[model samples]
Target chain A: MLQVHQVSHSYGGSGWRKSKAAAGKVLDNVSFDLEPGCCLGLLGTSGAGKSTLGKIVLGLQKPASGQVTFEGFELYTKGRQGIRKVRRDLQAVFQDCYSAVNPLMTADHIIGEPLRNYERLSPAELKRRTGELLEQVGLAAEDGSKRPSQFSGGQLQRVNIARAIALKPKLIVLDEPISSLDMVHQTLILDLLSELKDSIGLSYLFITHDIQAVMTICDRVAVMDKGQIVYHTDSPSSLPSAEHEAVQRLVSAVLPQHPSLRTSWV
Target chain B: MTSTHTLEVRGLQVRVNDGGKSLPLLKAIDLTIEKGQVLGLVGESGSGKSITCSAILQLLNRRGLEVEGSVRLNGRQLTKLPNREIRMIRGREIGTIMQNPMNAFTPVYTVGSQFVETLRTHSKLSKMQARAQAAASLAEVGLSEPARVMKSYPHQLSGGMLQRVMIAISMCLQPALVIADEPTTALDSVNQLQVLRQLDKLRTEYGTSILLVSHDLGVIARMADTVAVMKAGEIVEHADVHDLFDRPQHDYTRMLLQARLRGRKDA
Candidate 1:
């Protein structure tokens, strides 16, 4: 479970000044909450400060104002100790799988790196656990030896997911997880994520620019614009009727799946 | 004999020289784009879609990759042309819009300088004339306050803005064909719509044939008149956009359409 209360942030000039009214605020009074075992789709256009909000939620950057609480512990108020206590329960999967991992390390080592950080495991135990994680993401045990360059974009993303789930985290902040992949791989990864969520009862903060993906996977949807939550809905099914400018723009931009459905375009 | 098609490619093949052995990157493939037609090339990653585009444009390095084919743009053979001649034809007769617009322009130079340079390179326009034309073209693409945009550097603009600038540069010359490789992949939905609308306008107004390469089926379904499905270096299926979407013949094509995430019906 997570809660974001009036989170705001700004870059430049005010780094140490602690100025409340910074010139350009990246986030402005953004607030939301995620329930246990629920997926919340954070939808926004580019430059809408979605990534800044994600970093704040992940505890990578403390917001200048407001608070982010995870598992009932205040992350920024208590400083590093607050996150360190619940670090095992929180994990993140970024968009670029290649940049997320080291090119020199093999898939096994990349997944095992997190396990080594938290717990003491022998070499044999690490390899065994890595293989299990790989299989959990629909990868073969033999793929453990392959490096990042050796795997395709989809396969590399799968390895990244394997690494994220290695700690059995309760929540994962997925930032544009399938944006870099093709439709086939996109569907495959989304299906895999759904399976994992149901199987492990995991929660997700799904941040993306894709409306279709949000509609397909999210239990609840929130539309962000200019660093604020403009629209919130209990289900994606009701997103079409939302009157918010941001939500309407997102909905209208979605191309029909088939040409027959695109009668108005021509 | 005069060919009515704006672009034609036949038996195109690309093989990378890996040490002593050769690895085939693209099989013998054929594609044609008539005047004002949009040809969509859809495929998975590493399926040789980019290689096919490079091979058509003769952009592949001859030393590392061997391209064998006949590529004709407006009846002028491209594959056999010398580097100098290919360079002349690239921007003048055929233009390219890549996926990442940031890489298309130099980081240090302002957007206006790059746009002016490209215009002058392809045409016999003076510095003042090219600058005026550049601003005009940028304005045509719906960039509000073109004067301000022309004064700013490429990094100062967003991806959508840069992409529109790329489009403006590519279309200003009225090239016979434009190769747009994943033009909207980097943009969000709202920006994606703007880019797509600009492209559609060019095809309708200027009669510019487009070779649209993308993995997004929805984009292809809306933009392309004909669709070519590529799989592992081969064109598995090529059909009218409607036919391809409604009745996909190839197993790979059907699998691709099925993989598309359909919006929730309740919405």
Candidate 2:
């Protein structure tokens, strides 16, 4: 499990000294918990500090204040070994599937990179595990030989998901993973995320601007606006009724006035 | 103004030749936008939606693209027009708002100067008049203190602001048609709604027909009077928004609708 506690971060100030000019706070006392097999959704539009928070949680950037604990061990406070251990458990898949993977690397190699870093697997075993990862994501085994450009955007994202789950990580930060995809493909990716979580008991920190995507996949939703969580709800259906003006704006923007698709053919 | 049909297309086809063989990118296509109506074109990437828009604007000609068919703007055949004449109609008569706000703007110049230049290209407006028009256009998009925005460079503005500016400038000329190719796709939800609202306002006030090309079904459902679903470079189905969503005729259209509305509106 992952727990982020009162993490605050800022960027862009005049000097390095403590009494220096005030900086723009990208994250202000943000906190969240990811249960072992549940999904926690963070919904924020542009400039809402979601990405900044993602970086802080990933240990790519240290928050100015507060802390992140993975499996009850302080994340950033720990030294090299602790960082490495946490890295193995915390995975991420970003929006740009094309850039998320190296164009030069083959599909299986891309997935195997994480395995190679985190585990001590022989060449043959690594190859087999890579193939299994591809299959788990509903891709063909032959796809392992193909390059990133050879595969479509959706396939590349599948490969990224394969890479994320390569080590069987405890938590995967899905950062707008399907935003670049087409609608049908978006559905497929969301389906895969749900399947992966339920089947393998994987935890997800779902980060997206899209309300529809969150509703389809996340168990609990947290609405972040201007670097703070304005609304948190376990019931996504109740989102439209939230009192906060920010939440209301997002809800109106998300919910359609009429039914878009019919459940039954009637 | 007497013509109910603002723009028309008939049997539009695009073919690209790589090496010796020609590949059909867009099959014979037909669509129309009536006066003050929003015609939403929805499709996946490479569904030739953007290509269709380019074909309307006659932009594919630059890529040595072989385009076959008739594209008429208010009864004037655009495909057969000479480059010089078509250039005249490109922006002023048939305005465009593409996805990327940054690419649409010139980096070196202030936004006001760019607006003035764009306005003067098709119209014989004086510099002073163009300046006033540019500021007015900005304000029309709900940007307060339009003068400050005009003076600022494109980089100074946020993506949402720049996109609004794009919407503003597109409508400044009061063109008969506006082909917005994913105009709000790059912006966030708040800005997306704002842009959508602005486009709706344009239909009410200016009566400018819009060819809205977006992958978002939600956007199409909200903005469009008619919706055309495209796949593999062909229009699989075209119908009124209600019919398109309620009773999709094509299998692909049905699947797309199902994909977006797969689960409960919220889990």
Candidate 3:
């Protein structure tokens, strides 16, 4: 389980000068919870701080206010060792899989890095585990020997997911995982996520601007706007009943059947 | 509204040399965009939408690629034209708004300087004349302080603002055709809507035919007069916007339409 309580972060301005931040507040009083084995969709437009929230939760960035706790322990306050343990339980599938992976390293090294760090398996054992992870994410074991450029965008994302799951993380923060992919590829990745979640009992913080993809995969959804969670609801049924105007607009824009729904907002 | 355009493509085929082998990227593609019409090329990545636009401008890399097509603009065969002639036609007769605005502009030059330089290159306009025209164009694209934006560097502006600037630059020449490759893919939804509205306005005011490339079906529905659904380097379906949205013929098109996030509740 993961809990984010009243997290706030701002960019620019520092100390006594008190200048208005050029980029403004990145996050403001954001709070959310993720139960074990349940996917939570963080839906927002670009620049809505969804990724920032993920980073804060993952301990990549220190929040200016509030605390993040996992299973009753303070994530940031526990320091490096605690953070490392937290990271062992959590992993991330970044939006840009190409950049997330080192171009110099082959897929084998990329996937094996986490296993090498967390586990003391021999090189042979590491290779076996890497192959299994690749297979789990719908990639061939032989493909792990190749570089990132040799694979397509969809394949690269699968590799990324494979690496994330190599550590057997309880939660995977997928940031715009399928946005850059094709429709067919997007479907494949979505299906893979669903299958992995069902089998592994994994929780996902599915961050994306596209609502339709989230609707298909996530069990619950939170609509974020301007550094705040404006709406939260259970997926499938509660999405339609949500009161937030922004949520309604996003829902209407993504839906193919409702051409007239967001006309007034536009 | 359906008046025939000067632009025409026939039997277009593009092959890229990958590892010493010619890999077919697009096969025998045929497309036509009438004057003042917006044609949306809807497809996922590697769907040949970008390649088709690049071929029209003769911008694709020649070493690793071969373009075999009859691309005629205003009865002039673009494929037969030399680089110099193509350069002359480009940015003047045919404008382009690339996806990444930051990469499009020079880092050192101010927006004003680049605009003036671009205008001067295509037309014999004095610095003062070019500056005034550039400012006017920026205003037309919905920038509040056109004068201020002209003096600012590309990094000084937001992605949406820079995109508007790029649109402003493209509109300055008032080209016969505008090729926009995922223009609003980098922007927020609000900015995306704003840019789309501006693009629509440009078509109405200047009668500029547009080739809008994107994966978003909703965007195509909102702006395109006609839609071409591309898949695996081929145009699987082509129809009017209303018809394509109402009755997609191909399975892929239908799947795309179905995949679109729908309903107010999901928002």
RMSD of each: 2.3, 3.8, 3.5
Each predicted complex: what DockQ? 0.63, 0.41, 0.25
Assign candidate 3 its CAPRI class.
acceptable
- Docking level for model 1: medium
Q: Ten-residue segment with the worst summed lDDT in candidate 1 chain B?
A: B258-267
Give the alpha carbon lDDT tens digit for every residue of B135-180 in model 1: 9989999999899999998877999999999889877898889999
True contacts kept of each: 0.77, 0.51, 0.12
Q: lDDT tens string, model 3, A1-266?
A: 89999999987667864574577788999988999999899988877899999888777888989999886667787455657657788899987789999998999999999999989999899899999999999889999899999989999999999988987888899989987775667777888899999998899999988777777888998999999999988854567567688787675555234333225324
The CA lDDT of each predicted structure is 0.89, 0.85, 0.84
Per-model TM against the reference: 0.96, 0.92, 0.89
Of 1 and 2, the candidate ahead on lDDT is: 1
Ordered list by DockQ, greatest first:
1, 2, 3
- lDDT score for candidate 1 against the true structure: 0.89
TM-score-wise, the better of 1 and 3 is 1
Give the best candidate by DockQ.
1
